[model samples]
Target: MRLTSLFFFFISIVVFPQKTIKTSFVKKTKLKAESIVSVTKSSNYTSLKYIDNQTLFLKLNDSIIYNYSNVQLGDITSFDAFSPLKIKLFYRDFNTVVVLDNRLAETDKVDFNVVKPYKNVSHVSTGFGNKLWVFNQDSQQLELYNYKTNQVSAKSLPIQSNLIDLKSSYSSCWLLTESYLYKYDSYGSLIYKIKNENYTTIALDYHDNILLKSANNLFYLTDYNQTIAPIEIPKLLIKQFLVTRGSLYIYDNEFLHEYQLIKD
Candidate 1:
């Protein structure tokens, strides 16, 4: 009788395997724009920047056009639109960052080589109160730099993993290493460290939602760390993707696809 009961229990477990319920919903919208190099969405408008050889073209909200070309800065290493009024353009090769106004005009410039201690910065992102979150490669740590004061206001403990990427918002900074992802608050306090699971890239929306890309698949992580796959993505293989606000942008075959994500 005991053997029969154990056999039935084993069968029930196989028949009633747990199911993973998706917690997020998304609606995809396709927009046709040609020869687009990059797209960034802000609270008010979307900025599309394109490059053709030595010349650069920028279209704001599908209407305005801005052109710029500079051989000295080389290719743009990072384009941060965290603040529409104060966009950040980092040239890693030159160890410089250019601040752009809402009109995409150069307003300020910072060269890390001139800073004391002569720190070598590899990554930079917008931060609150006229500051920037920069990754000092020489120290293998994150630093909150006050551009106005030209000082390092805060710094995190030295990270001990191979750095993959770094991203930041007004109030928080996230560093992704080979083994883990670290989140730091505005004061440089370590908030959380999550073990990575083969995530190649990550993006944080304005709402603090985390979106991750692994291989060709994109996944969204809920506050509880539930992995949810967006069901409405295009069938084409995603070459690259980014999340901003409530939208997911996918690039495939020279086409930029935009999807609006709705939380359920």
Candidate 2:
């Protein structure tokens, strides 16, 4: 009987986690755009890809706002505003990374196509210590690139799967491929690898918790653990989702709904 009970306990934890997500019914605001390409939130700003993918609009502290558009660079693949002072805008089609200031002014640009020892960069994210996390699709590696010195300081072994999404903090980075989710330290060392079940998006919450989305469904995966719990919420058309400071911001076609995620 003791062994049977222990087995059942283990099964309960692995198969029937009781964690849930409550919306908390927060405020909802309409975006100031007809179409939104993407959405991301930072400590003090909310960014939206507006007016055809070329324009980026950012609202700061709920009052100050700024806008930037680059017609020559074409559409922006993504942007990183973790540090409002040093923003990164990636134009994958042009193989360029545009650095912007807090006021959305262009400060610098890195064209991988013309850089010596050319790199076919597919993704770029802010890294610690004046660096950028670059994913080379051709080489299939994550490189810690020193943008100032124009050198790769560290890199991981070639990844076998194609990268779907990537999110990084000050000292760590997470890479999501079609088959696995990989975590690595700042030195480009693989910390762990776990199988993925078709998660299309990954974001860090206010507490730096991992949030994932797959096919209109949201889930949470704990750090360095295999447990994944569903984040339950009221059904809505999810065009994009952003998690910031314990708040879940869901964007539909016109409205941006804000909800506090209450963990039960």
Candidate 3:
């Protein structure tokens, strides 16, 4: 009877659902764009691709350097930054990628036309693997361009995946399609794919783990099993998601909320 009672108790505990706590945490110092610095808009039509604490580099037909202390990045088609010290800017019309040093000095210019012989240079997406992954429209394969040596290598994929959107954090790469989240390692090899099932918004941390915002719930992807760790964000429409270090920051309307990752 004792063993039977113990067995039932264990089963009951296992069957019961775990409680999710919504504990409040102290907020971090919020840095406002208007408070920290000012912007000198260069072109009437300007698009910003990336920003850090110190500089704002813009890409038009040509790359424009802005002192984050005073100017704003404008009319950018694409951009990739290795650090605050190193960056790569893509100018679509000229089919070029410009490398910049810490002081926003031109380091080198990469012309895709001469580099990848048979590939159409219309669209480009930068990867963190020290190589630029090019979608070759002519060959219908993904080509890796070595920016340092100016060498090109091609790999044949099973499907004709369009290079719709791209972003790199640390050694991980993210290629976003209309309905899929493609994860690639530092070597440009495909690692994982997370399908968008009602995914309204998404953000990637430096490690490439996805933070998915669907409906009113937040899920974190880490383990190979794809176990979801749900989080409670405020009841508002999320405008943007930015993850840096271990802090996940969400910009909703005029307010920003920061959450710290707790690993049990």
Candidate 4:
């Protein structure tokens, strides 16, 4: 009985070990901006998506703002900065996607309605090498689409929950559903499924770090462990937030605040 108790204790420690290191946020800079719909950053510039009098604007580096007025494309559902040169704008209402160059020029457009197999795509993000990761609502699965060839290279099994949000990098993708958060590789294989834990928003960085937001608070799960740590931010009603390239940006009161996170 004593030996059995010791074995179980060891198993418990191994399964539920706690990490001591903590992550903290330090405010670095703030910039005044218009009502931002979404924001993304690259090494060279920051992209801000905003609206003005029924017209949408893509502001880069606070110096140039490009205007896009296409009523036929419907509302912008997703703004993805996959590459420094190519940005993806997804329109869910019309089942269309527009690729923009760094200057926000329309370089290409794809309407999924004309594609064979007829993917009712609800979410889209840039994928590895000339591919796009798209979530098909009708099929309840994620597919890797080759835009150049207009073919689905690979697909995942049907997911059970309703997908609420999705973010992706070059090599992997993260899906936030009504019940869980799922991580998948480029081949559409499920690597992990984490419980939702009341998180309303989610973002995944290139390093595979997971950032989750619940109401006004932010939490993150580092790449090294499963432990979730809270990220402190100044007292401001956060309208939206995102994590990119080891930095966190929060939008509140018509201003975007950038913070640098240090893990200690």
Candidate 5:
């Protein structure tokens, strides 16, 4: 049944791709900061990033601030906070994933190295229903793992390309590879595949529009069949970027800029 769903989605994507999404950029606000680590849109209308120090500092919604520090797990690889109630911190070097509450208090930890049926996890994202989306490097597959049960509930077929990025919502997840973009449903069905076109990273907006970025600038496929269009903005350093809730955020190490997405 899973394979059938996968094949169906592959054919569906070839016939009916993503809808056309036109965008107009309107500068909203720009703020400057120092000693930043990284940034991500953790919610529909909010942006979050940490600052450098022994401890991890987070500024959320541009108002509330929180700090979480842990030195035993090894350096933080990445984080996912799409949920209002939880945050996931992946320490890739240690093959561990830590879960935190909204208050930044540690609530759970998973050490894959010590866990039964050891999984060489490469990436992870928060999924709905107490589950986590994990990329099992040993199998080169995406797994919808029930972290609470320490079991794999669902998984995608073995991926043939190098994984670039993994972005997920409660219902779906998108895997970015070196040459293709794959979207899988909650059941791990491969629903879509698109060209990478040199885009190194990706962000899924609230509208499910795919935002793309290359080494030089940000771009998006206005329509699946149409060529990608550049997201025009003032020339500045682009260290990191994200799209959420009809907004595009670009942050350098020092300056953070927000642009309203005026979709046409």
Candidate 6:
């Protein structure tokens, strides 16, 4: 009995020793940026937009201007500029989705109060193919709405669970429920479901990749169709991430970190 207890104690010490990683948290002031474009100048920083590579859209005194491109897109609200072109913006104030043109013109406006089949809309995502993925609170169903043609398509999802989070990129969507991540195509068809080991935060990266962050670890999921392989991020907890200007910008509470993706 004494030998068994000693052996167990030794095993526990070897197995569960405290593992520590040395990390230095520093506030990065100067970025390793090839080009720096200033988006906002004024103190309040009310309205700002970045479209494509060269254009910086700004709205001041009810006039919108494309700063770098030297073109005026005209008057649009801050929320209207949220979606921009090839994207959809879900305005929380009016419960409306505003669609814009290449020149930031109003293409279409989708009022959730009028068009939604269910009374409550829980979440909204903007996708390619001019579609809006809506999670309805009443039926607990996720549906795709074509604002361009004004058509609605339903998706098949599991029962009782609500859509906790949603993201869209290219022609795909990432829907997070209670325990799983459901990938849906542009037409709102369920393509695959990834069962997460723990509760995770999901975001859509450039080139249709998915960034899954569980606690402090960030995993880059390259191809979901093939075998899912997750590459761990070394030291930082990715608080937020965005794919902008063909680069992934990860925020870690203090500063923005950039990563260049290697295309195969």
The TM-score leader among the candidates is 2
Cα lDDT listed for each candidate: 0.74, 0.80, 0.55, 0.77, 0.76, 0.55
Candidate 4 residue lDDT tens string, 1-264: 999999999898778754433444545445454445456766798677765544557777765467765677866777677574677878888999888776668888989999887889999998876789999999999999998899887899999988888888888888889898888898899888889988888766547887888878888887655567787667777777776677777778566677777666
Model 3 lDDT per residue over 116-143, tens place:
3534654455554456766556775455
What TM-score against the true fold does each predicted structure earn?
0.79, 0.87, 0.61, 0.83, 0.80, 0.61
Ranking by lDDT: 2, 4, 5, 1, 6, 3
Which has the higher lDDT value, candidate number 1 or candidate number 2? 2
Error of 4 at 72 (Å): 1.8
By TM-score rank, best first, the candidates go: 2, 4, 5, 1, 3, 6
lDDT of 2 by residue, 1-264 (tens): 999999998898878765766668678887655444345566666655444447766654465377888889987888777666788889999999998887789988999999888999998998876789999988999999988899887899999887899888888888999999988898899888878888988887643468889888888776745467788878898777777667787878788888888876
Model 5 local distance difference test score:
0.76
- How many pairs of residues in model 2 come into backbone collision? 0
Distance from true location, Cα of 14 in model 3, Å: 15
List of clashing residue pairs for candidate 3: 46-75, 47-74, 47-75
- Cα error, candidate 4, residue 142 (Å): 0.6
Give the per-residue lDDT digits (tens) of candidate 6, residues 172-230. Answer: 77878777778878767877887765645666555677766667665556554423434
Q: lDDT tens string, model 5, 1-264?
A: 999999998898778744444455545445554333334554365546553543556666767478887888767887777785677888999999888886788888988898788999999888996899999999999999887898887899999999999988898888999989888889999878887888787776664566788886877654345345667666778877776676777777665677776555
Q: Count the clashes in each prediction.
A: 0, 0, 3, 0, 0, 0
Error of 1 at 162 (Å): 1.5
What is the TM-score (0 to 1) of candidate 6?
0.61
Q: In order, what is each prediction's RMSD in angstroms?
A: 6.0, 3.2, 8.9, 3.7, 7.0, 10.6
Any residue pairs clashing in model 1, and if so which?
none
